[model samples]
Structure formats: C-alpha cells, structure tokens
Target: MRRLTAPLPRCALVLGLLLTPVGCAEPEKDKVTIMVPWSGTEFKAFYAVVKDFERDHDIDIEPQVTRALTQQLDAAVAADAEPDLAVLPSVGAIAKYRQAGALSKLDVDTHAYVQPLRGLGMNGKDVYAVPVKADIKSLVWYDARLTARPPGSWSTLRDRSDHWCLGLESGPTSGWPGADWIADILLADEGVGPYTAWASGEGRWDKGPVKAAWTEWGDLVAGARKGAATFNFRAATEKMAKAGCSLSHGALSAMAFDSAQVKTDGYTYVPSSRGALQVSADFVGKFTGNRSADEFIKYLASPRAQRTWVNEPGFALSADNRVTAYDNATQGRIAAMLRSSRYTLCFSAADAMDPDVSAAFYRAVLNYTDGKDLTPLLVALTRVQRELGYTHPGSPPPPGPLCSPPNHP
Candidate 1:
C-alpha cells in the first residue's frame, strides 16, 4: 500500500473539524463503492488496483460483499440508492442489468482488453460495462512426469482412461464437473454456433450436437471408467494429483495446483485440435451518476490497473491481452494460451446460462454419467431452455471451426 507523505497544516486540520463533525469527518475525495463477487487474494489484488486509481484520481473506491447482486441491486434501483459501480462476474448478469436499464452509458474503450472480453460488456451502440478480470477455462492439468510429451489427441487421452482419477460430486453443485465435460465436448464438436445458442437460451438440448456431448460422456464413464461420481471438484482434483491421474479436464484453477500447496511442474493449454477452453470474466457496470465512477471505469481498462491484479498468485489472467508480465512460468503459459490463436476461447456455457437451466444441465450430466438413459435428461433440458425466456445476448460463439468430439486430451 502506498502512503501519502506530506503533512497537513494545523490551521487546515482546525478548519476541517469546524466544517465537518468530529469522528464523522467528510471524505477528502468522492467515495465510489463497487460490489463484486471477489474475496481472499482476489480481493486484495482488486484493492491494489483501486488504490492505484485512488492515488491518480480524486476518488475512494469501497469494495462491498457481492452475495446478492441481482436482488440487492434491484432493491437499490427501486430505492434510488444504488452504488457507484458493480463488477458482475458473468456475462448473463451484465446483459440482464443492461437490458433492464440499470446501467448508465459510458465511454470506456473496451478494445484495450482482449477481443472476446470486449463482447461481454456490449449492449449494441452503448458500452454498458468493461471487463476487469478473466479466467481461461477449457484446460487440462497433468502430472508433469506422465505428460512429458503430452498426448495430442482424444485417442491418446482415453488410452490411459483406466488411470484417470475422476469425480463429479460438488455437494449442491456436484453436477458442475459433469456439465463442464459435456460443455467442453459441445465446444469441441459443435464449435461456437450451437454451443453459444445453448448458453443464451436459444439452443435446444435434443439437437444432434447437444446429444453428442452427453453420449460421449456416457461412453467415457461406461463400466466404471468414472468410478468416483460423489467427490466434489476440489477433492477430485487433489485425489488426481495424489494418485498420479493422467489428466484433469478443466482450467488451470480447476486443478487447484497452486492452492493445493503441492510441488509440480506447471500446467499448459491443451492444443485446440484436441480440446476446448473457457474464460470466466469479471465485467464492470455503472449505476451511480458520478463522473468518478466513469473515470474508474476507464482506469480499469488501463494496463496500470490490470498489472496489479495479474500479480496475485493463481489470480485469473487479465482480460487485457496487451499486458503479460506474470511472475511465474505457469501463469505465463495460461496467459499465452489466452493470447494464442491456435486455442479455442469459449465461456462456461452453464455460467452464461440461466441458473435453473444451468442447474438442470448439471443434474442431467450427473444422472447420465451415473448410467441413466440420456433421452429423458436431454428432453428435460430442452424443455427448460425453452422455458428460460430471458435472453443473454453476449455469450460468445465458438472461436474457430468446431472439431468433432471424442476429444479426450
């Protein structure tokens, strides 16, 4: 944290007390509160960014708890007591608020960020938000010794199927793992069109591409290939690491390699031809009618702010592709993957989707992987997607040509 060096004069301090009540003194700078779903190390990094901005501008940013953004923001909107800004962690929320007219227009140039990231904050001619953080998904973490050459194809991936340490359990969110597998398969097989259609409540699960994702997962788990379906994501990844499992099919963070406190050679992006990747994004939205909020928005898109956030260990990669001075080789590889044209850039289809719709998909994946017929699940999913009337306009389309599935690696 940076400290201001100059001392205040006695007369100035006396005047400050006269103008403002003791112990409740007015702020020296305009206060701008921002709510976002960030805690722990991520919050520290976020505060660092805000501190840097505060030093440059006449504003103080207050970070708040982000437990109920939609409900709370709605209440605030009704009361007309909304905060200056908010950092929604998903594309769907950003789109929903913008469509509801809760966001104010801003001139923040999003092109300073990555190409795909720019789309998350769009509402046609107006830019409703600016992406502040992003996590590249669609990844594969492996045992460095085992993956020295790293298998380049699904065939090579499944060849070591028996050695996989698999699990689909996540307590209440248990089905997310299964859903990720299906979503990744959809991304690899259907490309961006059908994959994104499903995400935005515009696609049907009974379709060929959706069905294909479900069936392939079934084949992988057929006859105990997926032995552990009750362990949550963290447990599964840690188990895989300890058991020397061949590969964990998810993002860099999904493996919990950095958080696990275990030593190993870092992770790498699986080649595009062989697998798919997703990017979890944090988008900044404005509400208060304050110019300071607008200035903060522009600062967020600048390299100075992003540079601070990227320095936090295991923090998500910056949405700004132009900045890449990570502190470690693993972070560098993940950032490089985001910058590369060879890898597919996709969002969590479920994350960008309706909560109920995403939940249904997770449950369906779990049931289907646990040996239930996929027909009923797919039909149910299709019905739910149709019922989720709200639309999410910015869910990205596939980055390149979709490769047909069975992409194990």
Candidate 2:
C-alpha cells in the first residue's frame, strides 16, 4: 500500500481551472469506468492500482469484472454502453475499433514502449491504445531443484525431454501454450518475416516449417511423458505449483509461480532464433457515456500511475520501463525484455475469427497427442484461415532497430 508521491496537489488541478473568480465554485468530479479482463489473484492485484487512481484523482471508478471478457466488450460496443477505459487482450479488436472511429488517439509520447505492443493498434497512424502491460512468450521456466543449468536451445528442450515439463492448463486459452510452441519452433527454424507473414494471413500454415513445428511439438508430447496428453493443464500446473516440476515454456506472466522450491533458476528466455515475441496490446474499451475516460487513459500513461502500478501486486508487467527499474528481480527482467526485444510478435487468437474456429486450433493440438495425423489438422486450419481471410495481408515488415530477427541462444 505504498503511495507514490502525488505530482501537483489536488488544488493545482482546481487552481488551473479559472472557471470562477476567487475561491467560489467546487472542483468538477473526475468520474470514470475501467474494465479489467482478469480474475482471481490477478484481478485483485490490478484493483489495488485502480483504487489508488480513485484516491489520487478524486475519481470514482466503476470497475467491472467478468470472465467472458471479449464478449463483454462486444456487448458493450453493440449496446453503446462503452466504458471510458478498457484494459483488454484483443489487439485486433482495438484495430477494428480504431478503424471504426470508436476510440480516441493517445495524446502522450510513446517512445520508450516496446515495438510489438506499440504495433498492436493504429489504422495507419491514429494510435488508439497504450500498452499497459505485455507478456513475453519466449521464456522457458525450469525448476532449479531439478537441473542447475538453464536450457540454451530448442534442440536441448527436445533432446532432453526427460527434464522438459510443460503446463497447458489455461482453460479456453489452454492451447495457446501449444501455439507458442509451434510459433517458437518456426521462428527458430525460419525467421521473423515468415512467422509474421503467416500470422497476418500472408503465408500458408501447411508449409514445411509450420508443419515441421507441429511435428516437433507432437514428438515431444508423445515421447517419454506417457500421460502428457492427459495432463490437464490446470491440474498439471497445480502439480507444478505444489510439488515442484522440471521445466515449462510460457509467457513472462507465469513468472509469478516461481517460489523457493519452484524457483526460477536456469531459466533462459530468448527469441525462437526466428525473432518472434508474442505480445498483446492494451486498448480503451468503449464503456457507457463517460466523457472523462480519456483523462484516465492519460493517467495510465502518467509517470505517477506507471510508477505506482509496477509496485502493485498481481501478474502484471509495466510497459513503462522507468517504473520497473526499482522492481523485484522477475519484474525487472520482464521489463528489460520488453524494452530491448528485437520483435514483439502478436498472434491472431481473439480478433481474427469466431471462438469455434479459434478453439479448433487448440483442439487439434490437444487431441493429436499421440502424434496423430496433422495433415488434416493443417488442412482444416488452412480452410479456417481462408474463411477468415487470414492469409497474410502484406503489411511491410517491422522497421528500424526493432526489425532485427532475434536469435535464441
């Protein structure tokens, strides 16, 4: 509950407003709403910051929490009950909203933000979303109790399957870890350009590297871990949390799980040699008739807000590098990665297609546990890709220093 030193006093905000003559009228209320797309521990941690926001700005935040996050947003948009600020996971939706003129452009400078998250929004120039937090999918967290050395390459992860432990239990998004596996392998095997091309619907998933990635993942799942397929991601992760497991590959968001026994030691995080880093952008959801919502978004980008949020609990990482400099080891590491990443890659899980189509990608990988036929899976995915117009739409590759193809050690 540490409070960041308030910038200018509340009186300053009032003083700057020369609406009245002397000490006459009262200051206007800065009431707004925000939607947080997280539950349980993560939600609680983020709420701490929102409460602080309420306190500092003398604002009342109508905080809404829900499980069906994207649906909630869609409904909000459809019903015209848009909130002032929305902290959502859908970059494509943000793109759509920005295109449809539902969001206002951010007025702040965004030089220090990571490239991938920054790329999430914008219809050719009108930047609509500011990246609040991001998760890096290139990390492999290993229990130091099992092995002292961190894994260096994809070959090591495959060759030494005896120590490779994976948790795929994130419910509806459980298969995403599997997707990361495929994406990482391809990036390692090919380069960032190919992965980006495929994700944007330009490249074909049935192609060699893409197919090879699935094969590699299948071989790992079918190998020594006999019950790997049956390991319910939720249960498996719980098992990892309690008894301490070997190694698992996941986003930086999962670093909160590392404790004394399940501590992160030889954990190595690198681009898949292919240079793709999975990322999601933070967008302002249109909530009800709230005029001051844009001000809150500005607050989110404020130095005070950013600094305060990094210290807040839960599994969030600041997109602002300055705020994380004084954080704990894990937080600092994640912040550094976001700041220095060569390419911040984003996947088309939520925005590009219907839930059924998205679920198919997960089911295909989950059900094909015993190295089952993947040709049909790829073919099916190809059809879905075509139906959704997912073929890479040819946006020029990421530019400048951020365009380097990241290589994993």
Candidate 3:
C-alpha cells in the first residue's frame, strides 16, 4: 500500500506519491495533483482558493507550482506519468497533447467565455483547458516626474535621449521582449492582417514590414543607449523608477508600478497606430479525468472563484463576463481595453507559434541585439516559418453556439 507523506498544511508541498487515501472503510475521495506555472505569491493565492474548495468538498488537491511547466509536463508525458492536470502554455500545446491522448476532454459549461478565449485549447468539438489568468502586454511605463505625459509617438520619445530604460539580458528564453516590441510596432503600423499572417507562419520574417519594425525598434534602442543593452529585466523596473528614466516598456508587477506612472489609454493614435492585448494564462487542463479535478474546474469557472481572483494583487480579471469589477482602477482600465471590440485582441505570436520555430525566432532577436545584422536573422527565421505553417488551415470553429444565451453573459 502507498503511504501518505505530507500533512494538509497550507505550505507543505509534497512531490510524489499516490496521495489518494487507501485501505479506507467506506471510500477514499479522489486525490488529484495540479501543476501550474505560478509560484510564490501566485501560488499562495491559488492555494487559498484550493483550500476553500477543499473545505467545502470531498476532494484532495496537491498543487505543484513550477516555472518549468512545459519541461515537466513533457517529461511526465514521456514517462507515461503525466499529472492529473496542468496549466499548459497555450492552446496550441493543448491541441498537440489532446492528439497524443495525454489529456481528457473537459466537460464544463464554457458559455461564459468569449470567442477568443474559447478558440485556443479547443478543437471542433472538444474543450481542453479553463482560462485562469490573462494580461495586457506592450505597456510603456514612464516616470510621472520625467515625462509630462505618455508620448504620442515613438518619435516624440526618441527626440529626448538618455531618457529610456532598456534591458536584453540573455537567458534560456531571451529576446522575447524584443519580439514583443517588434510585433506591437508591426501591429500598429501594418494592422492585424499582416501580424496574424506572420504569427501563423504564412508570412515571411525577411519581408519589408518585418524588417522595418526591427529597424524602428533598433532606432529606439540606439537613441537611449546608456548601459541599457545589458540591464537584465530583473529589478530593472524598480531601478528605472529610482533612477527616474523617462520611458520604459514591458510587464511590471505591482511593486514596480508603485513608483511608475499610471494612466488610462487616453493617448491619441495616428492612422497607422495599433495595439495588441494577449489574454493568456496557466490554463488548467484535467488530463486524468479525475472527478475531483472536474469539480475544481467547475468551481474555478464560477463567479465566486472569479471574484476572488480579481481581488488578488498583481492579477487581471478572469475572462468570464460575470467578473466585471476589479480591485482597483488599473485592472479595471486594462479589462475595459481587452473587452472593447474597437481594439484588436491579438494573442502572443510567440505563444501561438510552434515551439521550435518560436525558439528560433527568439534566439535570432537575441543575437540581433549584439550588433548582429537583422537581415540574416530575418532570412533564417523566415525559412523556418514557411516550413511550419499555421496550427489550423483557417480560423477555428465558431464558438457562437456556446456563447449564445447572450443575456446570461
């Protein structure tokens, strides 16, 4: 018989075991292990939700938090020992796993989720994951004291030198930030058609628009060169706030936002202007079809669970429309932008692309920062892009039927 190794304390995290109680008289409730990418405070918040759910139900949840979710999941699937569930990286990944028979189709009411949220992790008839968290990307953080207001154009900001904080620290997944910069600029300059084509691998990286975006980004970095190239994203935002750098771009947590400027998207846009919001998450997928996990998924989609999520610090609102309020004005504004039909809700190109192809693109961008010419990098990445092609032939199936009962949302 398997032995229980850990107590049900709030902080005790056990790694391996058949956690389901055995040798019981009546019947042991289903014990499920859920792996997610959220660690530290995010894990704490997640545990609180699990703890509350456990208190009211007959189930045991072993929450495993790891940043290397993809690697761990891969290893598990290889060894024929995948976890009961996980918040996988993307719906594209979900499709691959679903095809491999590594996951079970979810049986939950998805009517509340919007079309974009439903499209990912879903095939023609089956749903795989439940959206847990999302974010607004391509944000530019400026010091209120350094700049009177957000710049109308990159040109306006470039007019002032030595006022930007930039970082391109090399890591395993380095250069993603650069890709984001180029993609955001491309979306705004060329519109969604080209961005979607390029993201899905139908377009070429060496094309004029792609190269132009890279050049524009390079020009931005060149004008603000001051130990900026090696800043490393870690603590850079805090340092920017303290050093009073006028302009910065990237995701900054609550601590960094304290010293940085905050404003609504009142900045005017030109004719070619564009913005993209990616609503991604450590999406939960029930792989083993454990009843306990299914119960948890239901609770997760409920308004009560969503309300708790919105109140947590450093988190955006759930994709569910019932969760309309935020703990503060910042989340509220970001949610408004995401839900607005006027603005395009573009998923992350890197997240949606094939892993190997995406890695190549990321590496090429990283190399570009070290004085390497962008021409060859684009050429090589474009070659890989052409070979892969999009995840689906055309747009995914319409989720209008699920999102029907419009009055409910």
Candidate 4:
C-alpha cells in the first residue's frame, strides 16, 4: 500500500502558484538588429557602445557584420528581411534606399553636426539617416623624420610619389583610396564649385577638372609599388615604416598604426592645403519601425555615445560638435576640423554618385592604377552616369548639399 500524503492548504497552494518558476525567470529583452560592415578593431569599438546601451536599457542589440554590406543589404531588402537598422557607407546608398522606401524617417537630433553631415540623409523635411562615424579624407599623414614639412600644395606632393605609401586594394571597395586621392586633389586644385558640380552628376567627367584630376592622381601613383593594385590598404599603411615611405594620404583611421605610434614624435599629419577637406561618414538608417531600433539609433547619435565611440581603440571620429573631447590631442584636433565651419567639407565624390556609377568609378580607378588609359575610362564612366540619371526625369535633385561651406544651410 502507498503511503498517504497530506493535502496542501489553500494558502500554500496560492503561494506556490504566485511563486512559479516561469515567472521567476528574467523577461525576454527587445532585440534590435543592426547590419554593419565593420570588423576587427572597428567592430570592437562599435560593440563597446552597444554593450553600454544594453546595460542601460532592457534591450538586446544583434549586429550582423558583412564586408560586402551593399550587396548583402540589397539582397536583404529584396527578400523583405532587412535588419532593424543598417550602417550605410555611402550617401548614394542612403538615397537609393530612401527613394525605394526601404528606410524609415529618423527622429534623432542632428543640430550638433555641421552642414552636409546634418543633411546627408534628408529628403525635404524627413530625416532618413544620421552619420555615426566620420573620416577626414583630406589629411595627409607623414613621418616627420623623413619629411621636414608636409607639402605646401598638391603639385609638390604629386612629384614625390616615390616617398608615398599608396594602396588601392580593399576587397570589394579596393579602389576607394585611389578615388579619395582623386577627389581631394580635384577639390583642392579647382575649389568647391567644380567639385560640387561633378559630384552632383551635373558636370562632365570626360572633360575639364574631372579629367585633369584623374590624370594628376595617375601621375602621383605611377611609381607606387608593383603590387599596390592588390595590396590591402591597411597592410600597405602598416608597412609604411618597412617600405621606407614617409607619407601616407588618407584618413587617420585608415593608417592602421597603433595609438601609441600616433602619439609619438615621428607620426604626424597635416590638413590638406586650401581648406577643402574630403570627408565621409558611415550613416545609420532605420529599416523597420521598431521602437527599440529607433532608441538604439538615437542613442548612437547622442553626444555621449559619440564620445565613447571616438575614444575607443579604433580611433573613430564624430561629426557631432557636442562630442568635443577625444582620446588624444591628434584625434581632438581632427574632430575640431570636422566641426569647424571655416573649412569647406566636401562629401566623397564617388560616395555621392549613384551606386552603379560609384562602382564603375572604383573599377576605373583600379584600371587606371594598372596603367590603363584614362580618356576612354572617363568616357565610359560618363556613359554610366548618363544612363542612370541621378533622379527620375523632371524630379528635384536628391536632398542635401554635396559640399558644405562656411555657414551653409
């Protein structure tokens, strides 16, 4: 016979139900998915901010990393499987998605950012994207030991190509470094008027300043390493000391040098002459109408978050003026330049072109680097630009200025 058990009291039974194991477990967090192209140190810096956000809110951030962000994002949008947020690397992509209705309006405050940075993702009154990270492409970093002073002009630097550490390879975006060189040279030599016209798809590529800019860049890199076309940009940057090259022209973030090295006497950078700086930003845009995603994006653009990100190991810069301090004097100075209205900050030309046109421009850069003629290449690029008119026929131009001047709207 089984032993008899006593019946539970009603009070005890109620207490047991109230203290159920399921209810004792932690509640599930709202997950916000963000797709980005950063990895290694860049990803680490970004993740640190994400972790901080996770700690302060009852939300979980799921980051999907990809090197080919453009292609992957396109595929995701086509499949109706877009992430809650995505970091768009180019203004062109941002406009494309915005026009396609894939991106949602952002409600973050952008008053702290300067002109084009503030307007990069706007379509009339709607805010579609916010710049999360900025790169000052108009900087030329050099080893002070080898070069007494940075070149006073682009022409002076052009003839010293042998002392330059140039690399064109960056996977799918291999030719972008070359592109930046050309854009910066054009902007510096010709000023903002022609630069803006060419970048806005209103100017011809096969003639005048655009053609001259390409020719100049080709001459500068004519003596670059034989394997530069295939050399990884980061590796090329890191190998500068070993290669006996004293000068490297690009953003500080692309230098791939240690923070300690940057702080040393040997490493230094000078702003590109003439006060025309080529800059680019990784813009974050919302894809889904999730509240968590909105909060995440707002937080990412916040001054506090921007500060945290810039101080991290990767040495990212912020477009937000409120993010005033930096990890070091070098970074602080650069950040100040970005916020200053005294200098005209121009968006990357290829980045402002249509996506198809931008890719074609990249290919042209590579071919030119490989000793191919530039006239036919420019003509071919112009044809691509003409075929994919920047906007629909009779439609107003895409929102935002391609180049920002002092006190610009």
Pairs in clash, predicted candidate 1: 137-278, 138-277, 138-278, 169-232, 170-174, 192-398
- Per-prediction RMSD in angstroms? 8.7, 10.8, 9.3, 2.9
**TM-scores of all predicted structures:** 0.77, 0.77, 0.80, 0.93
The weakest ten consecutive residues by lDDT in model 3 span 397-406
* Model 3 score (lDDT): 0.64
lDDT of 2 at 153: 62
lDDT of 1 at 348: 70
lDDT of candidate 4 vs native? 0.83
As for TM-score, the candidate ahead, 1 or 4, is: 4
Evaluated at residue 228, the lDDT of candidate 4 is 81
Candidate 1 structure quality by residue, lDDT tens digits, 1-409: 1244344466688888787775586557888888775555667778888878888787888887665555566678789888899876556666556666788888887665555566656756578888788776566666665455446554355555445446777555557766777777677666777887766666678768778777776665464445466755566676655754556766533435654332235444364234446666778899978888888888888887787778765456786767888765566667776667565566677767655566677788777766677788888888876666344334323221122111111
Highest-scoring model, TM-score = 4
| TM-score of candidate 2 against the unseen true structure | 0.77
Higher-ranked by lDDT: 1 or 4: 4
Candidate 2: tens digits of C-alpha lDDT, residues 140-258: 65544445454456766677634455555464555656766777676666666666666555556676777887888776655434455556554554444454465566653354464
All models: lDDT? 0.66, 0.58, 0.64, 0.83
Relative to the true structure, candidate 3 reaches a TM of 0.80
Residue 157 lDDT, candidate 4, scale 0-100: 79
The 10-residue segment of model 1 with minimum total lDDT is 400-409
Off by over 4 Å in 2: 1-30, 223-235, 241-244, 252-276, 285-289, 341-359, 370-372, 390-409
